[model samples]
Target chain A: MNRKVTPAALALAFSTAVTLAASPALAAGDKDKGDKEKCYGVALAGKNDCKAGPGTTCSGSSNRDYQGNAWKYVPKGTCKEIPSPTSPTGKGQLQPFQEKG
Target chain B: MRGGGAGAGLSERLRGAGGLTVEERWAVALLDPEAPTPPDLTSWNGSDPGQRFAVYRNNVVVSLVESLAQTFPVTCELVGEEFFRAMGREFVRARPPRSTLLARYGEGFAEFVDGFPPAASVPYLADMARLEMHCLAALHAADADPAAPQVLEAALREPECLPALRLRLHPSLRCLRSEFAVFSLWDAHRGELEISQVNPLAAECGWILRSGLEVRLLPMCAGDCDFVEALARGNSFGEAAEAAAGDREFDLGRCLATLLRWGMVTSVNGIK
Candidate 1:
């Protein structure tokens, strides 16, 4: 309850940090590399980077109808390794991630 | 394009469409396949209006599911595509977009995943989705020039004024705290680490900041997370420092240094 950060501590922190603050920002030339280094692919499938309007709901593309709930699919991702308490063995298990009817 | 009588009659019927207009009915039907096609609607060639309506319905559902996939690719990857698509379909149908700004769509997908019964097995999936959402938001956030070193130097001159100083971080900077090792999990997906190396149950703090066009996800210590949160909430430098100082691992100088090194400090104010 009696936490207090003294001005001396603040001054010391700022003084040490000032050197890093003095460094220059990244130059314009890095923009290309920056663009390339983005974590996710810039051109994701059917994604236009928020530029285009919402996908046309009325488009007449005749795709096969996908019916039924996602219950048939189980937890098949990287989370398979994550420990789950629900597993009877008390180890990571590939549990069916759906509510059975 | 249809004959005047049929089209006009359809319009008249739509006008008195028992509380819901034809367009609204169709819009609703687009998301729900079980919903019947609007009455008296006909395709150009008259080749079964239901078939034509089904195509549009498919596009609406698939495109929205695709958008959710793109927005939460990691979450999608975690559950794999097939399951992600199915789950996304459920999310799309349950929470249809009310805004045309597709960029902001799927903002609630994280919360949706959290409560989704199917995803109960993967508890961290929601947090991962939330992290991905923050990354998307950071990528599109407004740009700001980082505060220069002179600002810190000016403030440093008056040591007593230091406690009251408030810092303004870049708009794109975001912090996340999770009971799971969400940062390590995400980093492993980036190929920076192996899945075997991560213990998902371990708690972790993460920071996302856009330096130039790149959105960087960096691991943070518990102390640094508290420090950033306090400062973000408009707590004075002293208050934030005190909050972090409680943790023995915290180093005020290093945290400040890293903030500047990443060009995250946009402005320094509250000094006389």
Candidate 2:
């Protein structure tokens, strides 16, 4: 009267357990929500704490909290800051903090 | 018909090949490490070799010196423009760029500064260069997803059972403990504030981390620095804390909170 599970069934059970164990209560997509959207500091130009989004310009003076820190959210119309012409931003657009050479 | 003179055909083919001899390679590198090929004398066909060579030399020296200036901005500022350029020329002669990435071009500078006669008086200069190099390395490290507080809490619950809880450090986190307050020297040159209040002679532990795109420096206690080093080596949180708490000044709660806020903790594992 002993019942044994097949290897396939056991693997399925194990995988389900692993998935459940690894999955957080919050949705997977929401992991970076806090970091992706919330603006932590104001821009150096005294503009709005530029919303955390793609193409944001950040620098040492961008915001006190974010100063000397990397990865500030650039709001729309704001250009990315390039340390040098050789910087990854390429050459077309002017970075917010760069002086024209 | 008029151009195929003695050795002229051989020279033309060699020039077209554009490869330099060992001596020529060294000479070109000595002039400009970034230049892909040695200058072809044939291109100047009857032009003034002196003028062309001068222009080429100037371009090479200017670009190399500029790269050094960018790499060590604070050092250049401290030494002044003219002296820094002179020093840069020396450095270029000694160690040319081995890679195209200028950010990585000055790895040996701190060591060079140690032996550099003119910079001998500024004993802190080498240490400052080391700190700057660490900052650069931290900025370019690969990104990682930080671990959540709940995972850490869970691991802490079974500290004894947790088999070496692996904590992943942020890619852009770096720590440098030096006998001189090199961080202050960097800050002074940054021109952020007037009346700099840093003691260049004092020993300090400086940590750099990339929050978003900016690199922030944090001065840490010796115990905290040791704790970070331990964690970086893949020690469990409990083990690292134990080592850290060896120093009476280590405050576990505050350290954990600071790391969390900085996004320095990338991942935590060992929780079942």
Candidate 3:
């Protein structure tokens, strides 16, 4: 990274990495970025956007990486260009990933 | 298994035989340890489910109280752990968690403290607790990009648009006015001031906010507090300044410089 990623980004990465990466069903509730769509497999564990899953006891509590249900708000056109270590295609996807390994 | 026994019908009547829904039974059972287990819990039974129910009830209430203690650390510190735990026990039983957002756990605790006789000796404690709660809220609010200095300058160049220009303050901003020196007390507890010499009678006014992910609690004078409060309450810059005029020689330029310097104003909207 060329610049400081920010504490907020680190926290965001930790939270969005969970269920939002795994399940697409819960991603629709969030309406913060109207022009953005749910980008999966991009948020690192504990970096998911918005609220955590059902067992989320506290704020920003994601403990898993590339969580299928966890998602990030990516510009509508840029999701596929982003890289994901866990995604089968080695890049982010607009919808939830079907992890191969 | 009742062999036409009249007792069977009475017990049945108590457990949904007449009216209580499954959810109601479970909810009622949680509050009253003596109540029979809800019809849905079919896992165990050496005898009456009251013992099992009591165990589950204790765990739930204890966890909720623990949540409160975590949410209001300052409040817990003020009353000591044991006293706060006891108070939390009573608080949970009286007013249970209505929202699932644990981050917002103690929203009503200040109100509860106001009515609690044991805590009445320290009348200002509730307001202090309220301040702490607001601090938590500010820390967790959404991220917003502040309006650049040039943006403010451009808006000011057109004074006629001032009243219509709605300033978008940072999402984490909150103003609080209180009778006690809560900012000092909170600061003292945090090692910013000496707790022993801090006076409780001194009135304090301030706002709590997060600047670039760092939560800050800053004290303000009467005029500045009222000025910001008016704007936060939805008054335009012109209207907010006009409302704040009664607050002892309010200085608009100084207040504007301070607000702009701190990056509190995010985006100025509402002009055609």
lDDT, candidate 2, A38-98, per-residue tens: 2232233222233323355433323222222123343333433323232234422322223
Model 1: how far is A16 from its true place, Å? 1.3
Task: State the lDDT of candidate 3 residue by residue for B1-272, as single tens digits.
Answer: 22234656654555565477566777767866566666645434446555666788999888888777766777788889998898888888778778887667777888989999999888787997899888889878998776764665565455556555577677788888899998899899867899988898899888898754346888887777777877788876656666666666455555555565556778877544
Fnat per candidate: 0.63, 0.00, 0.00
The lDDT leader among the candidates is 1
DockQ (C-alpha based) per candidate is 0.29, 0.04, 0.02
B129: Cα error in model 1, Å: 0.5
Which 10-residue window in model 1 chain B sums to the lowest lDDT? B1-10
Candidate achieving higher lDDT, 1 or 3: 1
Per-residue lDDT of candidate 2, residues B1-272 (tens digit): 12434755665544433465545653664465465444444443787654665677777778888767766777777778898898888888788777887656788888988889999888888887787777777766787766765766565556444435566789788788889887777777776544358778899886788765556788777767877888888886556766666667655555655666666778877667
Off by over 4 Å in 1: A21-101, B1-18
Question: Where in model 2 is the C-alpha error above 4 Å?
Answer: A1-101, B1-29, B32-40, B192-196
Instruction: Sort every candidate by DockQ, greatest first.
Output: 1, 2, 3
Ranking by lDDT: 1, 3, 2
lDDT: worst 10-residue window of model 2 chain A: A61-70
Of the candidates shown, which would achieve the greatest DockQ relative to the real structure?
1
Q: What tens-digit string does per-residue lDDT give for candidate 3 at A37-85? A: 6687777554466434665533345446676556776677888887888
Candidate 3: stretches off by over 4 Å: A1-101, B1-18, B34-40, B44-49, B270-272
